[model samples]
Target: MGIESVLSEHRTFHPDQTFVDQANVSGMAHYEKLCVAANENYEQFWADLARELIVWKKPFTQTLNDSNAPFYKWFEDGELNVSYNCLDKHLNTQPNKVAIIFEADNGDVTKVTYKELYEKVCQFSNGLKTFNLDLGDRVVIYLPMGIEAVVAMLACARIGLTHSVVFGGFSAKSIQERIKDAQARLVITADIQFRGGKTLPLQAAVDEAFNLGGCESVIGTVVLKKSKDPIELDSKKIWWHDLIKNQSTKCDPVFVNAEHPLFLLYTSGSTGTPKGVQHSSAGYLLHAMNTMRWTFDIKENDVYWCTADVGWITGHTYVVYGPLAMGATQLIYEGIPTFPHAGRFWQMIEKHQVSIFYTAPTAIRSLIKASELNKESNP
Candidate 1:
């Protein structure tokens, strides 16, 4: 049986210290009533959630259609843009609020406000249009966890292009497979990927993938320079900064239907070929908003950190889409906990005052061991 099948254990974790004095913290009774209402009328529940959480260009007429049992269509007639919901909605109320706190592996830090993010997304969107690609064109993004990575994905969404993000650490064979599968005409990758005391030549891997992986559809490669050292450029390679420096930052967002594909992410299929999983734009946005608000108790003032690479779904959902859609600021650290020192993660929490943090169990075990070893070695 699949997990998450039994979400409710007839109890709640509401009214925590974060909301003890607020009227919104009416205790478990409120959640119980909601649960009962949702269970009794799922259609109305979903419709209400979408209406409240999502920013729609055109209101939806239908909530769901499960006629095709295996595949269900939701918010069938709604029109929206994921990028707009994430950055644009917060422009009026909190333009200066930090949307992303990017800390590189080398201890370099940068903050992107909502207004800044919106402009950058628009600029990148215009830059992407320079390729003369039409709506629904695919762009494969093989980038590390950085502000630029977020901007790239949002740019694709803003222009109605579907982006397939391959993990930065993925091998050339993997990148080639995903790019070929998506038939992407453009590829965006970084010059290098830094992890602790190591560096991976990411663009080299992308180039190798193109040579070895049947990339006849690829027109050009957009390279992001994470390192200060200038990388040699070729006819096929375009500097990411050069493309955006003179571009217009006032591009309009293309409104897509709710069921339109937002992004195509791959799953590591141990036995067979990795399969691309497609996510709908509005459905995904709403799910992320509701999940973060209820599960993590994400607040407007909270600073969240999910220790997962941007390539993975955890980071894609929490670090990029979910928190941003909720108008919440989050930390995007492009390094591991064991990097520099075992206490790096703790130091970051204190430095940024992170309220909620999520990580894999494996990371927890490794951190514990590293902490003990560091204490022994230092003492």
Candidate 2:
């Protein structure tokens, strides 16, 4: 029997469950239409999309720029602060809307509203400014999947500070290399990260990395205290609350060049150091938001879950930037799939009634091996 038939013989999905097959559909066909339509009457399409999504301080005369090296600039010469479009504008329309729903391994959960998130982001952004981290300065983030990490990132973007987020699981050497390559002036990390059944010391890794020769010795390492285990706190390391506690929640967003590098994500290398995959601010946001719209079929009320760490481009594009731009509810999961059991994902899905789920293909293969899909009670 074929695998499908064999699987059907042993089990099957619930009749009510919808099977979505968008793979066979030409992904490029729609984009081709967009490109053609965009080219035919570039001004109209560009203006419509721009007016719909972005907040323009000054309207643009040009729709696109082909002279750039990276080659795509949407709404060129248009003035729009990325953070303003993503956070502030959303606050006016949907201030009370739930933006992030965090699900932890310990079954604890929290939801953050756009208004609340905006305040936190502003305070964090202001706090970073107090450290003299101006625009173009790099902030290396070594944070696990959580709201704070997202806040730190948005705060950086708001102020035009380039952020380089390292996955929480990478080794000290790897972290050091990225920090060095970016020459980050500030490092943000948590005291302890809880994943699966293990407690990882994130701050310790940051400390070890700081010892290496990349980031300047004068760099500030801000530690968020999430766990209590008498972890050594250095003089150079300041508590998150202490830094941002008295800071103002109101900060002006800085407008940057359309082609200016927004964030640098280092790709994992096989034999040598990772290559930093840089993305421009305006174009990247537009592409990311557009992809999120069609690829996931996002709805305003949909509870979206992207099972990828912030370290990867998948997380940056799908989890944070894409959903946030679309004003969709995103779930930040802070643990491994096998933690406790493979049932964890299903539990979240059933609990949240998640409308759209996006995970890596590797995860699907793992699920096939574990036969968890068959283990579903409906099967």
Candidate 3:
């Protein structure tokens, strides 16, 4: 017999009138109009967005290439850089605009502006070049969620390198498998990760992954110094600060074909082996930008917050690429929602003046449980 459902949800909550009035998609009519436009001419719909949103070195002639079924291509002939769309284009208008507002596990906050972020990304991009990596080369980023993680991803994107970001929470075996599969030539990670009011070893995991074999393609490891504790550095180890210290903060963006890969994010491998999912430059940016605008109704001055690790796809699309592509300010927290106290996330939202928040159902459920427990204890 089929399993019977024990839970049901029939509640429907409408948006506040204030929100509806100011949203990018003001009402159902506006949303339907967008859907109808796309449904009428799907390719042209995307093509128009690509041209309007992205600054291309060479504009695309063809929108969708489906000559080979199931192995489709998009904006195949265009030339553009993903990092430029996210960072460089925003420099002239809002260089001083806050791009990332990072909240540390200990409740410390650091704000990075667009111009500062651009310079740092360029410096790191130049540092990566010193390793003699060729275009389209794969780099494995195993860093925790922070400004450096975003920098590493953008630096790779700036120079036409494809990055595969492994979750910091993954085991060494998982990291080894992904490194082997990507044939990554370089690995970027922090010496330690701060989370849940505790410091955890991160570089050690990379070391163990390398020692497990099959990571021969990796030539070096760039370690970001986070902890005061001393750690052993080998020949293959390069300090992230040292690598970029002598480099110029002006690495030009490497424009590649629109179909060129931007990043490779792996699946959880819950059922089987983890698979690397590749996203192309033009199409992915177009989707991320549109969705950020449509779903979040992101405004210029609004401070957005998405509680997801960079290792996951949601973080990739929303936390880093999507918000940056839209030139929206975002908050990045480097700890669990319940760290230090049950009211951590709530306090942060108010402290940062976050206008929009996005998170997973699991996080919401956990927060609810925390609230219930807190009420019982206090009462």
Candidate 4:
């Protein structure tokens, strides 16, 4: 059997079926050749790909420049906001296009269109502006995968705020460490997360962290009311829907310097503490967008499924950054794969007809274990 068939045994959707219809290139060996060729002729490769995928405000005269200390600068002196390239240019052509498909633990699904996503992102950006959070300020987002999480991250990117998204499963102590390290002025979170048939008290954890006073320096906190039961808040907390929806959807994108700090993604330190890895906007976008286009071979009609949580760079890059930049239809699920059954992810694939499934090795192993359990039980 081929690799696609092997993947289909675990895949929620069938391969061969037109999941993703278009791409600039494909194949492992082909990608190896492309990468080797690009490294050999780096300038031409980046220049050609940028011209093909992105709408540049100022066409680049030079592609790769690494003179900046510890910084990789691509298309330096280019004057386009990364968010602008991702959203505005595509709006005219695919305004009504599906951008994000959200699947929750309770079997509920919601689709947000590009136009709707653009408006929501703008509103969230304006909401941040209302807090006087501007370029270079840090925002911490600890929310589940859904339209709001995606919008919040992009909104921070839109106005040049360096956002650090903490995984939903992280402990309060872990959350405090990131918030304190980023010196975040603002925080966005949901009251509770429904997963594995249990109510995860995310708000309570936030409250505990705040009580520890590690994040006392934060200027404001925003809460999204996902559940009906009201979650308590301090004088510092504000309602997300109340703060964002009223804002204008026409905020101009903030064009940042090429070497500006785009974000700080924390990884596990050898000593056990998480160390934040800083990334630059231009080069990071170039790498992420190029990978998305090639890896998924996504087209206009493709319903892409990136089965990773938003907390990891995988989700941040593939699920939000990569797919949205290309204007591909994306499916995001918020729960454990076995919450209802091992087949939950596959069910989503069948239901959404997902293409381009991306997930972690941990999950693959889990599914394999689940298959073993099913066989043992059935026998």
Compare the candidates by lDDT and give the number of the best one.
Answer: 3
RMSD to the native, candidate 2?
Answer: 5.1
Query: What would the TM-score be for candidate 2 when compared with the true structure?
Result: 0.86
- What is candidate 4's lDDT per residue for 127-228, written digit by digit as tens? 889888768888889897788898888888889998898889888888888888889899899998888778887777777787777796689989989889
Cα RMSD (Å) between model 4 and the true structure?
Answer: 4.6
Tens-place lDDT digits, model 1, residues 1-379: 7666644558766555646544342457888998898999999999999999999999999999899977999998989999999988998999999998988898888998999999999999899989999888889999988899999999999989999988887899999999888899999998998988789899999989978958888999899987788568899889999889899978888999999999999997578999999998988889888889888878878899988887988878988899989999999998888889878889999999998898898888899999788789889
TM-score of each: 0.93, 0.86, 0.97, 0.89
* Candidate 2 clashing pairs, residues 3+ apart or interchain: none
How does model 4 fare in lDDT? 0.81
Query: In candidate 2, what are the lDDT values of residues 121-152, reduced to their tens digit?
Result: 99999898988876788888999889998988
The digit string of per-residue lDDT tens for model 3 on 1-379 reads 9999976998999999998998999998998998999999999889988898899999999999999989999999999999999999999999999999999999899999999999999999999999999999999999988999999999999999999999999999999999999999999999999889888988999999988999999999999999887777899999998999989989999999999999999999999999999999898998999899887889998999999999999999999999998999999999998898778989999999999999898988888999999999999
| All candidates in order of TM-score, best leading | 3, 1, 4, 2
lDDT of each: 0.89, 0.82, 0.94, 0.81
| Total backbone collisions for each predicted model | 0, 0, 0, 0
Which window of ten consecutive residues has the lowest lDDT sum in model 1?
18-27
